[model samples]
Target: MFGRSKPLELNVLVLRDADVIATALRTALAAAAPEERPGLERAAALVEQAAAVPDAALRARWVHERLTAAGHEGPVDSVRAVKTLRESVPGLGLLSAVQLTKDAAAHRP
Candidate 1:
């Protein structure tokens, strides 16, 4: 008897390392549309900037600033905030995104 095929499931990629993030960005760039290219390029540049920084705290602070500027801060739902952060900064890992969300929530007005 023939076996049934399993349904396709979406997988989440947690990008933490700078090299891995840069590779993902490059792959995205290859397939992105004209309008989307600019944003992806910007994310790639951010990854480079973060990689160049030797201090971990400074990099985290820079990432937080970027996340806040993109309106991924405040009392927003944690799940949504993490998702938005990943979307905005493709190089951000799940743990970092969650921490950043909590940090934003703590400083909410």
Candidate 2:
């Protein structure tokens, strides 16, 4: 007898690795419209190297510019920051969840 295939499920855990997240984000960013892609690509590449905590924060702060350059910063431009983060992460913890990255960095696990 033929066996049934299992349904696919995507986990929604918040990732914390810049490299790993950037790889996944690059794919999502490619889904944007043609005109609004270049900036996203730039952000993706830059984001890929945001291994440093400060770089990650800087990227998040200027995420709008990066997306705008890509040609997709629209009415809800703020979303760009959220989207950028969704794609690339620096690490997760009470510190990051509450913007205490510097403190967390100072105190390594």
TM-score of each: 0.37, 0.29
Give lDDT per model, in order.
Answer: 0.69, 0.48
Question: Pairs clashing in candidate 2?
Answer: 39-70
* Model 1 CA deviation exceeding 4 Å by range: 1-16, 55-109
What TM value does model 2 have?
0.29
lDDT (Cα, tens digit) per residue for candidate 1, span 49-95: 97785544444455466667788654443687678877887776777
Best by lDDT: 1
lDDT of 2: 0.48
Candidate 2 lDDT over 45-102, as tens digits, reads: 7775665545444433443343445555343223443444334444423223323322
